[model samples]
Target: MRELLRSAVAAGACALLAGALAPATAFADPTVTIEGYSTDVRAEAVSALVAERGLGTASAEALLRTQEAATSALDAALAQLGDSAAGGYLDESGAPVVNVVNESAATSVEGVTTRLVTRTTAELESARDELEALPQVSHTAIAVDPVTNQVVVTVGEAVIGAAGTAGLLAAAERMGDTVRIEHVAGGFEPAIYGGEAITGGGSRCSAGFNVNSGGQDYIVDAGHCTAAVSQWNVGPSVDASFPGDDYGLIRNDTGSAPGAVSLYDGSVQEIASASDAHVGQSICKSGSTTGLTCGTVEATNVTVNYPQGAVHELVQTSASAGSGDSGGALFAGSVGLGITSGMGEDSSFFQPLTEALGAYGVRLN
Candidate 1:
C-alpha cells in the first residue's frame, strides 16, 4: 500500500512538471510594445539607428520582432504588466491606428511605464531640416507615421527618392559614420503634383501663385515661367494663361487680385490665407483634367529635373495629384496654402508658400 501510494504521488509530480514545461500561449501571437517618453522619442531613436547602424528594412523588422520577444519574456516574469508596453500593432494599411489601453500596472512593470510611438514615410520632411545640419551623415530622409509622432530614417540607398536620401546622408555624416559609410547610388526625383484637374487635352506645364511674407504679399509662380510673360489682370478678361507650371501669378495693373483658384464643380479654396502649410496637412487642388482632387503632403524642398531644366526645392507628397492640378490652390481646411505644380508619377511635389510670398511683396491677407 505504501509503495502504491508512493508511485501515485510520483506520477502526480511528473504530470505537474510536464504542465509547467509546456510552452506558454502568451508568445503565440507576435506583439510589439514600445516604451518611451513619447512616440517622437522612439521614432527618432529608430530613425537614428537606421542611419547609424547600417540596418536595412529586413534588419529593422527583425529588430521589431526581437523587441516583441523581449516584451514577452518581460511579461512572463512580471506579476502584472503595465499598459502592454503602450503600443499598437501594424494593420492591413501598413499603419498602426488601433491602440490598446487599459492595461494594469504592477511593481515589475512600473519601470516601463512609458509611451511607444510609431512613424511612417511621410514624417520625413520634419526631420529634414534638423538632419541637414549634420555632417558625417551626408543625407537623411524622414517619413512620419501620420497617426503618431513616429519617425523612420533610411540611410543611403534606403532613402526613398532623392530628397529622402539626401536628408539621411546629410544627417548621418553629421554624426560621423566611421564604420559603414555606404555611398548612395543614382539620383532621386520628387513627386510632381499632389492634386489634379488637368486632362490630356490641356497643355502640361508647372505653375505657382502669390504668397505673403514679413507683411508683404508677393507674386509667386513656377520658376519655369518665362520672365517676358508679365502683363496680366485679375478677373475673366484674360488672354493667355500660363500652364508651364502648376501655379502662376497674374500682374494686376489695376491692383485687382484674383479671387481664388476654383474647382470645376465650383468649389473654391482661398489661396492667401496660408501662412505655412505643414508637413502632414491634407491638401486639395484644381487642375485641367480630374478637377479638385485631394491628398497629403509627403515632403518638401525636393529638387527634380523637369524636361526644361532642373527645378530645385520642390514640395513632395503621396497624394494622387495629376495634371491641371498644377497652378491650382492647395488648401488645408479651406485655407489657401500651396499651389499645384507637377508630379513625377510616384509622388506629387510643390513649391513653398514662403517663396511665393517673397516674390509678390504683398501680405496674404
Candidate 2:
C-alpha cells in the first residue's frame, strides 16, 4: 500500500519519528483496465466478491453493473417517494428493493421492487432516538434495520451481565418487539495504530480521500485520529469533529494526488465521484490493516457508542476492518462512500463521505 506522500528532505525528522513516519515515495501511475471490467471495476474488489460470494469473474462484473444501476435507481426513488419511502436496499441479485409504507406510496416509485411495510423510516428513527436517550453504555450500538422494520440494538458480550445492560434490556423490553437486541463478543473502538499507512502521534490510520476547497488540498480521515494527532506525516490537522461525528481533515502539503485508493494489490481504484450509500448496496473498504474487503451495507443512520463517546449518523457494513484502518476509504466502484470509523463485533462502521464533504466544503479531487 502507498504511504502518505512526504517530503524526502525531512529524512532526519523521519528517522526521529520512526514508526510514526515512513520515507515518501511516488504513487503508482493510475491504471484503467482491471480484469476486463474496463476502468469501472477494481481487480482486488472483484476477487473479494468472487471469494466471499462464490461468484465467477463474469458474474461478479455483472453484479457490479447491477449495483451501479441500483444506486442510481434508489436515489431517484428516494427523492420521489419522500417520507412515504421507508427505506431502500439492494437485494441478493443486486436489484433495488424499496420499502414503502402503503400501496399508494409504492405506486410512486418505479424501476425497482417495492414492498409495503407497516412502519416508515421516520418511525424507526424515532425509536432509535428513544434508545439513545437511555443511559449511555459502552460496548453497545443502535441502528434502524429496515429489513426487519425495527430498531436493532447490539450489546457486546462484555456488558451482558453489567448493571447498565440491565436497564438497557428493561427499556428495550418495554418498547416491545420494535427493539431487537443482538449479542456479540468484543467491544467497539476506533481503529488506531497497529497498521501501516498514514501516521502521526505514534499512531497509524489510513488516508481517506484527497479533497480540495478554495484551491487548497486536504485529506479527510477519522476525527478520533485527527483529534489526537495534530500533525501527520503528510501534513498538519486542519479540522476535526468527534464524539457526535467522527470525521476530520488534514492539510495536504504534497501538491495534488490522484483521486484514487490503493488496492494493496499493485493497482489502484480511481475515484470518480462521491455519493451516499444505501442499505444493501455492495461496497468495498480499503484500509492499511485489511487491504481491500467487500460486503453489503447492513444499515444506515446508525449510532455507535464507543468507550470514548457516542457517534451518530454512521453507516454499518459487513466489511472487515481493524486497527490502523481508521480513515480508510469506503467506496462502491468509482464512487466514494465513507471514511472508516470503527468496527463492531460483526460489522464495521463508517462516517458518511457526503456529510464530511459538505461539512468541510471540499469536493473530491
Candidate 3:
C-alpha cells in the first residue's frame, strides 16, 4: 500500500465536528471494505493511527496493511466457518490476529494467525451479562476488552458515597477474575450545555452523523439530548432512547443531507457507513465546544452507569471532550464509529454507531 500521502499526525487533524448530509440518491447496505493501498482511506487510517495511538509513522503505515489483511481474513473465516467464529484483533506487531473457540476452526487467515479461547464469543458475551446483575454503582463503567480477554469494570469518585460500590465489588468477585476492576478519577457526564447544535428542550448538544431512514434525512445524537429537548436545529427530535441505550435521531427537514463529516480544517471526510469501534483503533471526535480531538478506543460494548441510569453498548476512548460534545461524531476516517455520549477526564464514552444505526433502522447517507 502506498504510504499515507504526507502523514498529518499532529493533533491538528481534529476540529469542531460538523455533521454531514447523506445524498438523496439511492443507498446501499453498508459493507466492510478493508482499505487498500494508495487509497484515501489508507492515508486517513495511517494518519489517525499515528495521531491517536502514538505509533511511529512508518509503523502506522505498515500496521494498516496488517489490519486490512486481518479484516479480510476475518470475513473469509466467518463466511466459510460457522457460528464458532468469534472476532479478530490487531496485535502489538500490527499483524491481524483472529480468535476462535473451536479448535477445528480455521486457525489462520492468509498471513495472519489465530488464538484459541475456552469460551465462544457468545459465551464470553454471556459472561459479560453478569454486569447487568450487579448493582448500579455511580461513576462506574463496564466494557468487554478483547485485549485483556475479560470484562473490565471501572470505578471512580462517583461511587464513594453510594452503597452500590460494595454491591458492585461483591458482584465482580462472584464473577471471578474474568471481571477486571480498576479505579479511575472523576465521573462520567454528558458534555451538553448552553452551546448550540440545534436548540430545543432548554439545552444544546453537538450533532452526530447524518442518516437516512425511510427515505428521509435525519441527524443522530445522544438520547439524553433528545429527552431533554425535542426541538433540534434541523427539525424536531422524532426518536430517542436513554438508560438502556443512548441514541436519538432528529428529522432533517432541510434538503440535501451530504454524506460527509467535517474535518475542522475546511475539509470533510465522506462518511461511507456506520462501524463499531474496535479496541486499539484510532478514533477522532468533533463537537461544537471541544471542536476536534483524537484518541485510541480502549474498549467496546461498555455499560456506563449514569446518575440517571445505565446506558449499554457504549464505546470507551481516551479522547478529550467537554460540554456541548454529547452526540458529537466519533469516527475513523470516513467510517462513522460512534456518537459521543458522555465523558470524564481520562476516558470518554460514546454510543456505538453500528448499534445506533441498527436500532433506528437508518444508514449513513
Candidate 4:
C-alpha cells in the first residue's frame, strides 16, 4: 500500500505534489452547457481534451457528444448482435464501429459502421485466458484486439531479456498468430503513495465514485489501496477485492460523499451515471499526481500481471497518470467509467466501474 498521511514528511510531499499538478484553471467555474446535450459538461474536462488532443473547446465538446451518442448505438448493436457481435469501438472520428462474425448480422446493426471479422469475441477471450493461465510473467499485459481479431500481449522492457520472457515468447509462438506479442519500455505496477485526495493508514489514493447500498453511502476506490489501508480520512474500508480484480468500498461515515469527481480545479464534475468503457472512446481521469488528463480508450477486458499479482478485466487507456493516482476517477463527460489501477510505459489500466458496482451491490449516489 502507498501510504502518505501517516508521517508529516510524507503529507508535506503529497501537498507539494498536489500543488504542482493542480491546473491553472482551478479557480474557474466547473460546468458548462454544450449544445444538443441535456446535462452540463465539466469545463475542466473540456480543457483536458484541448490540452491532449489539440482541439478547440467547441470541437472537444462536440467530440464528447459524438462519443456519448456512439456509446448508445453500441449498446443497442451489441444487444441485437449477441453472439454475432465480435466487439465494438469508436473510430477516430467518434463513430461507432461494430465487428461481427456473421456478415448478415452486421446488416442488422444500423446507425453504426460494421466490419466482418474471422473470430468471435469468445474465441479471442479464450486465447487471452490461455495466456493468463501461463506462468505469471511480471511486467506483462494481455487483451483481446477485435480490430485485429487476435489476442494482443504486451511485455515490458524490464523482462525483455529474462528467462521468463524467453519462455513466454516460446509459448506465444506455439499459439501462432492468435497471440500478438509487443514489447514496451517499462513494467506495470500499482500506482500508490504521495497522494492528496484521500488518505488512510499512511497511504493515499483518489476516490473513484460515491455509491449507495442499502441506504448506506460509500466511496469506491482501487482495491489495492483499500486492502492496505483499513481506515481512510473519508471513511473506513468495508470491502475490497484485489489480485483477481481491483476494486474496493469504503463506508462514507462523513455523510458528505457526493456523486462527483474532482477536476483538480476548484470545481468538480457531477457524475450522473456509470457506463462500460469502449475501446477508442475519448476519456479523462483526475488524480492527485497529474490533475486532469484526457485520452482515448485502447482496449478493454485486459489482464495485467503486476508484481503483486495478476488483475483481470481491466480497461486500458492512452490517458496519462502517475504515482499517487491510484483509485482516481476515469470518466467521459458525466458518465463514470473506471477506477485507476496502474500503468505501463505508454498506457494506463483501470478497474471497470460496472464490475465493481456489481461486486458491491451498489449504485451511483
lDDT of candidate 4 over 1-365, digit per residue (tens): 22432221111112224544445332123465653222323455566567666777777677776778899998889888899999988876678889998869978869999999888888888877777777888899888886677889899988766657777777778878888999899899898874243444566777778888888888788999889888876668998899899999877765455667766554466778899999878888877777777778899999899989899999999888888788888888778899999988989999999999998889987
Q: Which TM-score value belongs to model 1?
A: 0.41
lDDT of 3 by residue, 147-213 (tens): 6567778888767868778877777778787778888878878777753433445476777877887
Ranking by lDDT: 4, 2, 3, 1
**Number of the candidate with higher TM-score, 1 or 3:** 3
Clashes of 3: 11
All candidates' lDDT scores? 0.37, 0.76, 0.67, 0.77
Candidates in order, TM-scores: namely 0.41, 0.87, 0.80, 0.87
Q: Which stretches of candidate 2 lie over 4 Å from their true place?
A: 1-41, 50-57, 194-200
Cα-based lDDT at residue 159, candidate 4: 74
**What local lDDT does model 1 show for residue 146?**
28
lDDT of 2 by residue, 93-174 (tens): 6788889998998787679999998887888888878878988898899988878888999998866665578888888888
Candidate 4 weakest lDDT stretch, 10 residues? 6-15
Model 1, residue 232: what's the lDDT? 18
Off by over 4 Å in 4: 1-20, 24-32, 35-59, 161-163, 194-200
lDDT of 1 by residue, 160-205 (tens): 4644345445554654322123333322332233322122211232
**lDDT score, residue 163, model 1?**
44
